[model samples]
Target: MTDQTEPVGEVDALMRQAALDAERLLSGLRMFVALGLGLFFLVAVKPADALQEPVLLRQWAFAGSTMMGYFLLGLLTWILSARGLFRMWGVWVVATADTLFVLSGLWLSLMNTGLEPGAIFVFPSAWLVPLVLAFAVIRGDPWVMAFTVAVLCLGLALLAIGGAESGQQGRRETLDLFLSLPPNVMRLAMIALAGIVLVTAARRVRRLLLRSIRDARSRANLTRYLPAQLADDLGEVGLAALQRGSRQEVGLLFVDIRGFTGMTQEMPPEKVSEFVSDYRRRVSAAAEKTRGIIDKFMGDAVLIVFEGDGAARRCLDCGLMLRADIADWSKARTMRGDAPVRVGIGMHWGEVFRGVVGDANRLEYSVFGDAVNIAARLESLTREMEMDVIASRDLIATAKAEAGSLGFIDLEPIEVRGRTGALALSGVAKDAPLRSAGTAAPVSGSSS
Candidate 1:
């Protein structure tokens, strides 16, 4: 049993790690593609004859050198992407390339010989690529927005300086150029428009980043109420989606502190909070270890759910282990003169509909029907039976028979509210010996 379980556990861990690696690799590839395409457009386009003059060449050299540098930077980006370097580094490499490209375009526009203003056309488009890339790569970082704004300002400054220089050369007057006939005025208009667009884009990016950050923070906070798995699922699919309903067999486990109300009354609010936090941490660790999703925490109680039959058995095993852990934890607290805590847990299994339900303003992913209610009742039963752990007959029947190695006892039938038929239940001792001591606790309970 140990041999079989060990390899399976190792394999699952490996698979998860591999999936994360693949996602990072894909992100790197996306950055590379965006940078590569932008660079290609800049490098492939030839300089016009009018801008080929000696004065312009000297100016174009700055642009040319900058472009070549960006090309090399893009090459470096590809190398990092291909090598699958760190995600932060990959993002930075592309960001750097983009900055250089925008800088080069600005330099070229500055040195523009009035004869070929057409060369300035690429600056706006080129700058846009990096701005977009920066938003994509490091949306959380305000520095990306700062850098984008800096680039926009630099581009505007160059255009203004070039326009002034052209005016002195009898090409056109600066203010008149701004108000003059459609073409030159349009060119000036475009430069102004580009700055506005870039700034707007940056603001939009910042807003998007803030929204993402808020969502992440909310999800993190929600994880305290729900299991990490369910929290993540809620973040991805949303509470409304999950509440819609699905038929799947699930093992539900409920755990509540014995005499929790009395304990809280005896302690200060801060201490009560600390006590609850500590209990949650210990139980959550065990549940997560068994791949359990916490549904919710109601006062001193925690609801956990495990997905599959095998997982359900694992959850039951974990729950029993958790009881022992809690006992030890309580002993440690008692030695420290802190209040000791006792928990009663119950497990049940049945087909149920699970989904998210709520209005636009609020939402929650929760399970529905008699199965969930029965699980809650079973948890209540634990306090009455003087047992630390109880399991419904549904859980026992669904779990593989070999699970008997974990030590479960058959119990009398229980009639629950809202359900017409009586349901059989069982009990498991907290002190039950394990076949293997290190198995992780599994998740149990409805996610609500």
Candidate 2:
């Protein structure tokens, strides 16, 4: 399984997904605007007879082409979004396409008017530039808004230059009073200033959107640790599930950082915080790989729960991965002249009481039984035994792995605190691979 080492990449990926979802919805609206509604406006605004002429015919065709392009693009984006094939680049491309089409329509108007290029700004289509640029603010990216503005300014500038250089100096008398080079330059300046305003607006909107998405993702991460089935059982979907307990066979895993208390006692608060965050991130990656849910964490210790079929197998894999990963981390720290770190993992498989408690204000999903207690106790045993990993015989047997497989070595029954009887167990080292063989002991045990 791929490991999630960098959280920033994950957050950026989430933002892209959110942007594509918004784009798909915007595409649906664009479909409506491009076809029926646009046609209604076209028919009411322009006389049908005018389109019969060659010049008007060309403009009409361009408008029709723009509409068709809009419809097709909208449909394509919707289909891609449905298939989960659309990417952030596609969003930028669509923004560029729409901007091109809007400006192209106005560009087509200059050829139809039979007037000087100075009259291009006087044409009614010129009003659409700002409106289309404003439309990009919905995209929630300041860069896309800036891109639209760049394209718009470039198109308008080219049109103005072409008008000044055109061989035909003829102009419409009605607009001659206000359509001089000075007025056109002033209008271009206004467009530039308006672009700045829109870009500023986009930045503010995008900042709020990113902040909201980050906050939502933080809350969503909690659900990842709390399984959906557990949530369903905990009254998130219905009130009936509240204050009720259900029995579930689960693989319980408990992890504790070796010497964490002493390590933190010597470090500053900021350093301790950074160290703990890094430690949790490492364990979380291992848990994610094994499909284990971290039920709860207290500073340097975490309680993970694996349920259903193969829970024991996954739990063991999680422990093995965690130990291996933490070992690598410790080595990296040692090379950097920082204090080394280690973790002890304990695993047990048994039935537990699982359920939620409290009101709408607060709720907790608690897994309580001998299984959890035994798992925590075994973790403490790791320090005394000089073992990085340990599991009860019952857990190993449930995994159904063969002896000398999965790095499991049979061990004599070990006395655990708060327990009257000694429990049969298995042990492994930090560097051992989960599926690799290890020297087995003569002590009797179950399948594992």
Candidate 3:
């Protein structure tokens, strides 16, 4: 059996691309921030405000250089990411650079102000730590967020050596909470708490994104073998819910290409494949048009099930459409000196066990019962009766009452083996050498 679960590697690949896009967006935003801050320092802040002491102007020069470096690096990263040159590992590199640039600006600004190192907590630049962490969140990688927060907290601790008044010993009650070492210690704790929450939220978002991708792949797989509508219903209700099979009255149609084996015995493998593919396409189109569920197709034979109201009538119409289409296709092949393709259809309507079956290791939607068996039996007789379509009397009766009697020839009733009584059958046909000289009578078993 083929693997059904969506691969985790595929999910990871999608997330990697998403992370790249997020990083590029964060970089572009950072460039604007750097540009604005740099311009503010250059034009808005006067020289006296920028340099408390004329001699400290040299330190401010280094700070200004860091800002310029930040802007240039952000722009380059953004461009590289857009061109698909950036890698996942590069996210941590960018995060470190961003934290350092902001930290140096605050540290240098404090240096010029001559405030005790502890006063860095009151500096406006400290708020940028939260913004940096927020950008990390956009990357949707918890590891990146945790790394940025860890770096910022460490930098804050080093800057806060003893954040206390002279001889105060950094006592929590004595030193101003907002300005001193002890309170800012508590503030750092809060920041760590917030980081933890954001990281948790980001992890949850990643899981949800992966689940969405997995579900989409699974739905596509279902559509591959089942009808589009059935697949859609299963997706909405969920496959687990379908594990408990239900008894449903459905119109069952079984069809197989007549003489497929002998006709393709001498044909090349390519031709044989083409013949089967073409045959299925025609039948599927007809089935879809009538809203029939292509329960499954085993090689050249397909078992179709019609559901809901008026299923019997719709199934009959589908069979008729398929018969004529295959006949027309066969005639064209005959003209081309290729073997003609022909099919036989058997249809029945009744209650059947329909739902998913098997253990969790293997599960499939299936339909089986006496009704399904009767349908197959009828299709098998199509060859013996020299007919292209054979349908049960009960199915004909249902369709006739629901819509109107379909165009089918009344054939002699035959005794089906393993059944209690004879089954009244009918057919629509042309001719076949398989027809026996004996009249229609007791017959059992079928190739269908």
lDDT of 1 by residue, 1-448 (tens): 0112344575565545443343343344334434553344344433563154454444435544654564465455556545765455444445555555665555455445443343344333344444444333333345655665675566656654453244334344422322334324323433443454446546655875698799888777665544456654565456555666577778888898999898788788898888889888887887877777777778888888777537667667667767767877877888788777778888888777766556555555567667777778888887787777788766766665443555566677877776679887777654554333234333232111
What TM-score, over all chains together, does every model reach? Answer: 0.49, 0.50, 0.51
Best by TM-score: 3
**Which consecutive 10 residues in model 1 have the weakest lDDT in total?**
439-448
Please, what are the lDDT tens digits per residue for candidate 3 over residues 1-448?
1122344665687789878888787777677666655555555344665366352355447646876787788899989997889998898898998788768866765555555667676644575677677777777788888888899888888877743234433334322323544324534543554465456547757876898899888877765544575664665468776667678778999999877789989999998888888888887888888888888888888999998767887888787777666666777787788886778889887789988776645556689898898899889888898888888888878776321134467889878676778888778765522221111221221221
Candidate 1: deviation at residue 187, Å? 15
Q: What is the lDDT of residue 177 in candidate 3?
A: 27
RMSD (Å) per prediction: 12.7, 10.8, 16.1
Provide the lowest-lDDT 10-residue window in model 3: 433-442
Q: Which stretches of candidate 2 lie over 4 Å from their true place?
A: 1-6, 35-45, 48-65, 79-87, 163-168, 173-362, 373-422, 425-448
Count clashing residue pairs per candidate. 17, 0, 0
What ranking emerges by lDDT with the best candidate at the front? 3, 2, 1
lDDT of each: 0.59, 0.69, 0.70
